[model samples]
Target: MSDDRPLDPVQLDAYFALIEVSSLLRHTVEQQLKESGGLSYVQFQLLATLGDAPSGRRRMTDLADGVVYSRSGLTYQVGLLEQAGLVTRAPSQEDERSVVVTITDAGRAVLATVFPGHIAVLRELLLDPLSDDDVEALASVLDRVRAHMRSIPPRSAAPRRRAPTR
Candidate 1:
């Protein structure tokens, strides 16, 4: 089931570079989110997603999928946000079994506080060194890779099966 062939030098170098850069970027972003808004990266993502939605609301399952997070983890984060008065959870009127999350005004205010710093960090660490052409190429490549990865069933769609006992 395994390929015997190893990655070529170019592929190995690119893979390592990508992994390192992604880690660095996420670490910086996490720090910025925590410092500016007292939010974790995941919490910021949830609020930003809801804030960008047309109605400032989304179903729990949809949020999990959109954020590429586990439903249980998303639930925990939502609970924290609810406790902080940053968001609300309510039953969906259209679907009795579904719960919807809506961002509060306070959440928007946090976004406003954090976004400027976030953008500045991104610009300084990630984008400033890139040429316009490099930026466009990177965006295009990432978009395609993301779409391909997302074609698989997301964690929110179903629970993982338990392993059979020996």
Candidate 2:
């Protein structure tokens, strides 16, 4: 009367604990963003990329890569931020059809106010006791997770297709 269900206890417990920890830490970071930055976790990620880019800007495609979003999805997010005046979009000089997104002064202000608390929350929640070796090992495992899951690109973004001119 055995069922086909496979609940290997040891494996299940380890996986469940890892996921619980991940979610707990994510929630802590998100809470900090709301309290200090008034932004969501996704918004903070977008703002952080824009903050680090040259001229505080990057192509929509590039932003999508940084945020692990589809190009269209990131465009929509950027549109929302643009409407809020936290981001601005312009035609890329190097590629007329591609859009460049820049963080606005207001955006930077929010980041400046929120990012410190965000990092603090992250450290307190996840990193306080982690050794340098642990961090490197975690990074290795995360990279493997991404590779194994195919959740992110296995390769760079597909090259943009040029429009055919008449």
Candidate 1 lowest-lDDT run of ten? 151-160
Clash statistics: count for each candidate: 0, 0
RMSD of each: 2.7, 5.9
lDDT, candidate 2, residue 104?
99
Which regions of candidate 1 deviate over 4 angstroms?
A: 154-166
Write one digit per residue (lDDT tens) for candidate 2, span 14-114.
89989999899889888888899677777788999999987899988778777777676677778888888999999999999889989999999999999
TM-score of 1: 0.91
List TM-scores for all candidates, in order. 0.91, 0.77
Best by lDDT: 1
RMSD of 1: 2.7
Clashes of 2: 0
Q: Please provide, for model 1 over 1-166, each residue's C-alpha lDDT reduced to its tens digit, 9 standing for 90 to 100.
A: 5798999999999999999999999999999999999999999999999999999999998999998898889999999999999999999999999999999999999999999999999999999999999999999999999998788676556667999999
Stretches off by above 4 angstroms in model 2 are: 1-10, 147-166
Q: Please report the candidate that would top TM-score against the real structure.
A: 1
